[model samples]
Structures are given as structure tokens and as C-alpha cells.
Target: MIFTGKGFRFGDNVDTDQILPSQYLVLPSIKEMSKHAMEPLLKDFSDKFKSGDILVADHNFGCGSSREQAPAVLKELGVQVIIAKDFARIFFRNCINIGILLIELKEADDFQDGDVISIDTVKSIIINKNKTYTFTPLSNFLKNIISKGGLVNYFSAKK
Candidate 1:
């Protein structure tokens, strides 16, 4: 799928707790927890974030506990994709499981907060301003999973 959105820049090692603080994990649902996404770093992140926005960060983007709520909260907050230098292994899989596209790019600095970006998955490139960054495209199986809105949806459709 192709995605176009404004970038929300963040730094390195943004752990899961920072994404959705542990305290807020007590909340009943993803929607409730999403209201506090990036609260520790950007207090008004969710309020300022528009649907289909993108998150760009440095290495170890998701570096804490394997709290599935983290990615879920981001998706709930309308994050269409995340571009990071690298990701915590579990965090990477969790995002895919939840259908949030994750792109690995060592040159994420070009994406400043509020910069308009376009991700062409079919072409495996990200365009920000006049520059273009390329990444390996996810395999067709994973793409199918994401296209169906996550693993559960993918299997459900098969049935």
C-alpha cells in the first residue's frame, strides 16, 4: 500500500512505556490509551496528530517491553507508518502484526516534524521533499497481512 503523511520526528530509544506509559496501560482500550501516545515526549502529540500521519525516529525506536499496546496505541492515534533507523525486534513484529507499516532507513534525519512524506511501498521508496530513500519491501505474505489490517484479519478473510 502507498501512504502519504506528515512526519512526527522523535529521537532514539523511545521505549514502549514512553509510547504509552505503563500507567495508561490500565486504560480499557486502545482508543483510551492512544489519547496519551507520546505524552512523555510530546504532551499534545495525539491532539496535534492528524490521521495518516507518519512517525520518524532514530535507532531503537521501540526498545522497551513487548507491550503490544504500544503499536496499537500508535495505530489508534492515526499513525500510518513509522520510519526508523532500526527497531527493537519485538516492536518490529508487533507493528506488523497490528498492520502499521515500519520502514527501516538509516537516513531518517531528513524527515523533520511536519514535513510532508510519501511512501511508495510498491516501489520501496520514501520521498521527503526532493530526496528519496529506499528500503526493502516487505514480502508479499507480510504485505498481505498488513493490507488486510493485521494477522487476524488476514486469516479471517481466508476463511
Candidate 2:
């Protein structure tokens, strides 16, 4: 799949709480919880984000709690992809489980906030302005999972 979006930039060590605070976890739905996403860092992040927007961050993008709600909230807010220097392992898994694309690139720092970026998962390329960066392509199995909308739907379709 391919995704194109405006980049929303952030710095290092953005933890789970910053993505979706613990207080909002008690909310009934992800839609409600998303309104509070990135509240600590960017007060109006959720309100301003649009579908297909990309999140670009420095290393350890999801470093704190292993709460799956963090990525869930972003997905609910229509964030299609995230590009980071690196990701906390559990958070990385959580994002994949929920079908939110995450890509790691040492060159992530090159992207600026609001820069329009195009990601071709099929080609494992990230294109911005006059530049292009490549990432390791996803395995067919993983690609299938995401295409089916995460593991649950993947397995459900198998039945």
C-alpha cells in the first residue's frame, strides 16, 4: 500500500502517556481518547490532525508504558503512518497489531513538520520534496496482515 500525508513532527522519547494519557484511557471509545492524544506535548494535536497525516519523531518514539491505546488513539485520529529513528519494541508491535504503519529510518531527522511525504510500502521508499529514502521492505506475511487490517481481521478472514 501507498500513503501520502503531511508530516507532524516531534522530538525524542515521546512516551505512551504523551500519545494518550492514562486519564483518557478510561474513556468509552478510541474516538474520545484520540481527542486527548499528544495533549501533553501539543495541546491541540488531535483537533488539528487530519486523516492520512504522518507522525515523524526521533528515537524511541514510544518509550513509556506498553499500553496499546497509544497507537490505537493515533489510528482513531486517522494517522496512517509514523516514521521514526527507532521505536520501543512493544510499541512497535502494538502499532503493527493495529495496522498502523511504522517505519524506522536513521534519516528521519531530515523530514520537517508539515512537509508532504509519500510512502510506498510496496517499494519501501519514502519520498519528500526532491529526496527519497529507502527502508527494509515488509515481508509478505506482515504485508498481508496489515492489508487485512491487523491480525484479528487477517485470521478472521482465514476462517
Best by lDDT: 2
Those runs of model 1 whose alpha carbons end farther than 4 Å from true positions after fitting are 157-159
Query: In order, how many clashes per candidate?
Result: 0, 0
As a whole number from 0 to 100, the lDDT of residue 114 in candidate 1 is 87
- Candidates in order have lDDT scores of 0.90, 0.91
TM-score of each: 0.93, 0.94
Candidate 2 — worst ten consecutive residues by lDDT sum? 136-145
Residue-level lDDT of model 2, residues 49-110, one tens digit each, is: 99999999999999999899999989989987999999998898888789988899999879
Candidate 1: what lDDT? 0.90
Residue pairs of candidate 2 with colliding backbone atoms: none
